[model samples]
Target: MMFDDLDATVKALFDDAAAPAELRAADISFDTPDRAYKPAQATVNLFLHEVCENRALRDEARVMTRSGDRYTSRLPALRVDCAYLATAWSAQAGGLKAAEEHRLLGLALRWLSRFPVVDERFLRGSLRTPPQPYPLSTTVAQTQEGRSNAEFWSALGVPPRPAFSVTVTMTVDPFDEADELAAARRLHLDSTVMPHAALAGRVLDHTLAPVQGAEVTVVETGARTASAMGGEFAVPGLAFGDYTLRVQPPGGPAEQLAVTYAADHQRLTVVLSQP
Candidate 1:
């Protein structure tokens, strides 16, 4: 179920693209092009071969929304790359088979190249309904790391054919629900209203260097703030309580620490390992 919506969206892209008469009747398939597989008719096969995190587009900032008296903080969605090996198959024999397959593959490439990013109109299932905030980036005929074409085909126990790699970058949310918290309230001492407690923190790497632009969040109150140039951050208007702080550096892993925010203990330090 991981890439179910993405898979459907990719298929929908192919289904909706305008094609020549020769490819109009050809079937679109997601099955592996292995040795035992043989198409009874002309087909376009997009076999999902690799999936991995796209670190270049990675974002660690939390998205926070405020309503009436409540706040909701959601972790940033992860950017992932889904790579597919696209190949064309034909049931015809000899020269005719090769010619048809080459033409179909060429047309498919042209159709896909038209859109560097998949259009929202072609999105399907969950990808279309609520709509993802991030764009679906696409790359055609790009070489992917970790595997060679010949080795991949050999592993599938099939002869290598003319194929191109298509990698689609999509977002996946780690949490289904956002963390909710009530608005922080001020304390009253006799006739005077005391200021609300605030948590101040600093972010640093294992080398003790300040990490700027790091996101810091108070788990219990959904209070969020970004570290300054000196890795300093302050979350204002927080009620005194025991809380867990989540610190995420840009393009780095997230780290959490148990903390207590009181009148005397309002500041802390967090060290994040280099990614």
Candidate 2:
């Protein structure tokens, strides 16, 4: 997407410079393969340079997923800036001439300066639909230092000439982690009045033996439990209320009892005679 915008904007700059027929006399091109071919017409070339993340426009470390579940992005986006070098060439029939080169270079600078910020209206392709972050700017346009221009031209096998070092920042998605659909889950919290105490009891037979398989059921809530070892029956998390405790022993008739429960109540043991 960035390359598309860069190409279109460069094309627009020349159109704004003058008519295409007139600008063609200068032979403006984004390609820079042949540096030895001295065209009869003056030439302007654009060369891509450095690309680094734009930390200034870095977003927060939080991101919202499409599903809208509770979460945050641990990684940040890759907001980057791309650099390009726009240079001019001479229009001499023999080889190269500094005089004609400077003229073309001046015009190049003038036309580019007219677009300190590539207007959104002039934007093309995806650069327009979901346009780049506001005015697709051209902030870092100047002469670069540290690296020798002579060495750069030597690598290109051409004499060094002044060129515009341009930089434009754009945001790119690091991943499509949000593209897939995800299931959303909700959390529910239940409030409690007072803490509940375990309701424990015991069941016995006429021979003073413990009832191991006795069923202890609450009539009010229909909550049930089986008698454990030593005929012990315990149920937890019951609220303070009156419950008709029913004990239905295996192969025996059921017995009922009216039980009132409250906070910090003491445990009780129920003895079942032969029924």
Candidate 3:
């Protein structure tokens, strides 16, 4: 979700900042233009340079949504630094072309520097009204340690050009693929009067303290439930069989457990040790 938001946010910032400059708004383009571009026109291109996983912020081990009592599984959210190449372009034919290019580059750098963090007002589209309004951190790193700028341009098959690099850290939510796939139906079931077994447990962290709001999913089946007050959860209608359970708690890492659920073994306790 946040991947696209990052793109929109970058472009919107350029557009909003260029309004008073009387310069045409920049766009997402290549470092080297394919066609002739106006010298006065300021061309800005943002490219995904690198993505480094952020481990400092709070992370969601498991993404979830409650439909009544059942909690469904969704991929875990990722916190990352969206690195990009903010390149500017202008024509070089006219005598004043060099001045115009410098002006364009200066405008972008100055306008962008205004906001150490991209303002919410400048954020447009999906990012304008994000569900998780975590303000991304932006930075300009001219010299990237251990990486060669010459090698970068060579790989792009273009001559070296002046470009500013920016990194924005964003929290991205996991995508639910359920909508893209066709729904399956259970057409048959045993009508026998046998009682299904119950699974109950309290999730705990490495400290052995209760972890609240954890979701316990039976991997063999999609049935899952959330840990409530005191970190307790129960699923009462599970059929008797060997079950693989996945335990995921908010603010904690997910865990996997192999459990055998017969008449003698019903209650289960799970603990998470790693993130």
Candidate 4:
């Protein structure tokens, strides 16, 4: 799981020998710090308390990648914030336990606070080779706004302990590859511009077969064209107004219908009666 990788990454941050020997020797854990859980060794518990979308880093743009002859457009990766509650635990009793825990917690805070952005070397597992192209962002010892510490501890059935929040922002790409589009090899420019709107449609017979070579005309403008193969026809340079459309099938009777032509009135389907 991604969280498991994140846990490993966090643990890696404390694995350096340069840190205090006590801190390096302390065990790193990603477990629920509940009342029932008791550790026999000095442990730094990292409980993932919240997972949410980092709206502040939301990206609406799409990412485009071009292959040899095709290109794909995919939505940008989502930025997610994983917040962890970091606390220290020691097996010692009374004041010794509290002091050791505090010392470990302080050392952890010092180590974590140094990296606002996780170093690439410290990233572990899938995080080390993230699919998305965003760096892991970190926030240390910051006050998180969501669930209060008291409520969080209460939910875990444990008393509140001294702890700091560690938030790491990671990227998730959940969508499959977008449809690929073939590359355009050539461009055609049409210089003959129509001063007015155009109308287009297809001609079909009663049985829904294409009626090629049928004459179609706009009665008001006298614009006319013959339906080509596949029953497609177009009449350009027509004013925006009401007009009567007349369609005459080859060796067949003519049909007339009224239509209102506007810029958006682009298509019409003319179906002829069966012989």
Best by lDDT: 4
Model 2 misplaced regions, further than 4 Å: 17-25, 65-76, 93-96, 179-275
Task: For candidate 1, write residues 206-243 as lDDT tens digits.
Answer: 99899999999888878899999999888988877889
- Candidate 3, pairs of clashing residues: 39-91
Candidate 2 per-residue C-alpha lDDT over 190-244 given as tens digits, one digit per residue, 9 for 90 to 100: 3222244667767888777889989999888888999987897777868777778
Summed over model 2, clashes come to 0
Between prediction 3 and prediction 4, which has the larger lDDT? Answer: 4
- C-alpha lDDT of candidate 2 relative to the true structure: 0.69
Give me the runs in candidate 1 sitting further than 4 Å from their true place. 145-147, 183-275
Instruction: Tell me the TM-score of each prediction against the true structure.
Output: 0.64, 0.54, 0.51, 0.67
User: lDDT of all predictions, in order shown?
Assistant: 0.85, 0.69, 0.68, 0.87
Model 3: residues with Cα > 4 Å off, grouped in runs: 1-4, 17-40, 58-76, 175-275
Alpha carbon lDDT of residue 170, candidate 3? Answer: 72
Lowest summed lDDT over 10 consecutive residues: which window, candidate 3? 30-39
Report residue 245 deviation for candidate 4 (angstroms).
26
Per lDDT, what order, best first? 4, 1, 2, 3
Q: Candidate 4 residues 1-275, lDDT tens each?
A: 88899899888888976777898899998888998779889999999989999999998989888999898988888899999999999999999999999999999999899889988888888887754388898999887567567888888887899999999999888888696788888998732333455787789999999999999998887889999999988888776788899999999999998887776676778888756
Clashing pairs in 1: none
